[model samples]
Target chain A: MTIKRKILAAILALALPLASPVLASEQAVTFVQNNVSKVLQVLSDPALGDVQKGKLFSEVITQVTDVDVIARFVLGQYAATASTPEFERFARVFRGYALGVYQSELSRFGNEVLEVQSVQERKPGDSVVLTRISGGALSKKSRDVKWRVITIKGTPRVVDIEISGVWLSQHQRAEITGIITKNGGQISAATKMLCSQSKTCTVTG
Target chain B: MALAGCVHPPWRAKSDPLEPMNRAVFAFNTVADKTVLKPIAKTYQTITPKPARKGVRNFLDNLQSPVVFVNDVLQGKPKRAAKTLARFAINTTVGVGGILDVAKAAGIEKHYEDLGQTLAHHGVPSGPYLVLPLFGPSNVRDLAGLGTELAVSPLSFTRFKGKQTFGRVRLALNTMDRRVETLQEMKTIRKNTLDEYVSIRSYYQQLRKDAIADGVVDMDELPDFDLIE
Candidate 1:
C-alpha cells in the first residue's frame, strides 16, 4: 500500500474507535436522560397516577436495568466465588428487592432533580465518565454520579458507577449482614425471611 | 473530600442528626461505591439473568429467616401474626430455590416490623434522625434496630451453615445487585457528600415515617428543610 493510503487507513482506524466511545457515552447519557426523565415525570405530575408509575418502575426500569451489576455490588467481594448459578440467583432476588425499594422511592424521584456537572473521557479509549448531581451544600456543592461506558471486547457495556456521597456496596453488605447477625447469625435463615415477605419472591407459597 | 476529616460520634446519641463528623464517616464509606461500586454492579447485573437468579435471593433470605424470629423476640414487640406470616413465607421460599414470588403470590408480604418499628408505631417517637458512618440513615429506634439485629446476623451461621455457605454468596450478590441499581443516585451523592448526605437522610427519615405510619408518605408533608434554607 502507498504511504499516503497507509497513513489514511491508520487515521481512519484511530478516529473510528475514538469516535466509538464518544458515541457509546452519548448512548448512556441519552438512556439516563430519557429514562430518568420518565421517572421524574411520574414523580412530578401526581395526576398521571401511580398505576403507570408502578408499571414504569417494575417493567421499564427492570427491563433497562442491570440488576446483576447491583447484585455483584451487594455481594461485595463474594461475587468472585459465586458460581454461575450463585450469581444468577443473586441477580433475581436483588433485582426484585431493588425494584421493590425503588418502586417505593420513585415517588420521591420527582422531588429530586439531578443535574449533570460534566462528562469527560476517563480513559483514552472508549470510556467516558458522566458526572451528574450535587450535594446541594451552602457552596451549592456539586456531587457526581459517574456512569462508565466502554466496549468489552466489541460490545459496549456500562461497566461501573461511582456515587460520591456513599460507599453503597459496603453499606448494603453491612446492612444485610447486620440482618443476618441480628437473627442469631443464620445468614440463610435471615436472607430467606427477608425475601419471603416480598411479593416478588416464591417464598410465600 | 473535606467531609472526610471529622470524627465519628459513638454509634449513638449525637447532637445534630446530621453532624459534620458523622457525615464525614458516612461520606468516607460512600465515596468509592457511590463513585464506582454501583455502576459496576449495574453492569454485572445487566449481563446475566437466568432462572436461578430468581431463587438465589429467596434461598439465602430463607437461611436468614431465623433472625426475624429472634429480632421479634428481642424487642419485646408483639405482632405474633407478622411473625407467623414471616415463618410461613420463609419456609416456602427456602423450600424452593429462594423464589419469594410464590409466597408473595400467595399474599404474604415481607414486613420487618420488629420491636423498633413497633415502638415507632406505638408512639415512642423517632427521636432525632442520625446518619451513622456505615449505617446510612436512621433515627434512634432504627439505629437500635441495627444494633440489636447485629447481635444476631447470619455471619455466625457461617459456622454451622458452612455447609450451606451458598447463602453467603446470595447475600453478597444481593448487596452488589442493589448497589448497582442505585448507581446513578449514589454517584450524584458522592460528589456533594455533605449536602447529599443531609438530603438523603432527610428524605429517608421521611420515607420511613411514610413506610411505617401511612404506608404511603407524601413529600409535601415532610419538613422541607430546603437545600437552600
Candidate 2:
C-alpha cells in the first residue's frame, strides 16, 4: 500500500472505533437533553417527596442501568471466593442496597452541588481504576466533601467512598474481613456481614 | 461516599458488581469510539497538520539520548520506544506549535494509530474502561504504556541534565497542557454518554482489550437504542 493509503488506513481504522462511541453518544445526549430536565425537575420538587423521587429513579435512570452489573463490581475480589449460593444471596442483598443508595443520592442531586478542587490522583491496579474524587460541597455555605471513588472497568462504582478524609468502604471492608479473619478466615461469613452493612440500601431488585 | 442507602436490583454485578456495567459500557463505548471520536481526531489531524522542523528532529532525537541510553540499559524495547516518543512529544509540544509539524514531519507520531489502530481494525477488543484523573478513557495496558512513558521519557531526565531548568519547564508545560486537554474532554464527556458511569467504564475496557488482542476479536456489534442503561 502507498504511504497515503497506509495513513488513510491507519486513520480510518482508529477513526472507526473511536467514532462509534462518540456518535452513539449523540443519541444518548439527545435522550438526556429531552428527558433530563423533566427528570431533574421531578426529582428536585419539594412536593415530589421520596415516593415520587423513588418512582423517577426507577422510571428514568434505573431502567436503563443494569444495577446487577454494578453490584458485581462493588463486590470486588470477593466474587472469586464466593460459592454459587453465596454469590446469589450477596447479589440479591446488594442490589436493593444499591438502588436505595442511588435513589437517595438522586433525590439530593441538585441540592448540594460539587465544586471542583485539587485532586489526589493515581491509576490503581490493572483490573481496577482508583480515582480520589476531591471537591467542595455547595449548599448554602461551601464546605468540602472530599471523597475517593474507585471506578472499576469504567463505571464510577464507588469502591472506597470517602467523606471528608474518612475511607468509608475501605474501613468497612477491612472491619468485616478482619472479623472474618478473626473468626476462622472463611470468606462466606465476612461476605454476609458486608452484604448487610447498609440496611436501607439492601433490596431484592 | 457510599452513604447510608442503597437498594440495587437483585443479582447485580453477578457476584462481581462491576462486570455487567463493564460489559454494557464497553459495548456502548465500542460504538462511540469507532464511530465518533476516532473520526473527529482524524479530521482534526488533517486540518491541523503537524510538520517536523529539521534540527528539531535531531534536538528532539538527541533529547532521546537518555531514552536510548536507558532503554539500552533497561533491556526492554517497548519502554525504550515509549521513552523516545514521550521525549519527542514533550519537546515538540513545548516548542510553540512545533509539535504538529514535527509529529507530521516525523520525530513522533501517534504510535497507537499505526500499531494499535491496525490491531483494533482486525477485530481486537478493548478490555474495560478506566477513568484516569486529568486523563480520561484509558485501560490497564495503555496506562502501563503511559507509566513507562512518564518513567523514562528523555525529558524526564532533564533534572539529571544538571544545568537545564528550561528543558524541565518545557516538559512540565507539555505535561500540563496534555492534562488540561484531557480534563476539557472529560467535562464534555460527563454531559454526554447514555449512562455516564457505565459508558465510560465499558468503552475503556473495550479499548484495552482491543489493544491486548493485538487488535482482533470479532463479536456482536450491538446497534444503538433509546434504552441503553
Please, what is the whole-model Cα lDDT of each candidate in the order they appear? 0.53, 0.44
Task: Name the top lDDT candidate.
Answer: 1
Against the hidden true structure, what lDDT does model 2 obtain? 0.44
Q: Is the docking of candidate 1 incorrect, acceptable, medium or high quality?
A: incorrect
lDDT string, candidate 1, B1-229, tens digits: 6875565534222325355556677677677555666566766767767455555555545555556566555455457456545655655646564455465555565444455675676677777666665446677877776676656566644566454565556556777756655666665444323235444654465446645642422224321111111
lDDT of 2 by residue, A26-65 (tens): 3333333344335445666677777676776667655334
The total of clashing pairs for model 2 equals 88
Please report, as a residue range, the 10-residue window in candidate 2 chain B with the lowest summed lDDT. Answer: B219-228
Per-residue CA lDDT of candidate 2, range B22-63, in tens? 455556665665576555544544454233223333343444
Per-candidate TM-score against the hidden true structure? 0.41, 0.31
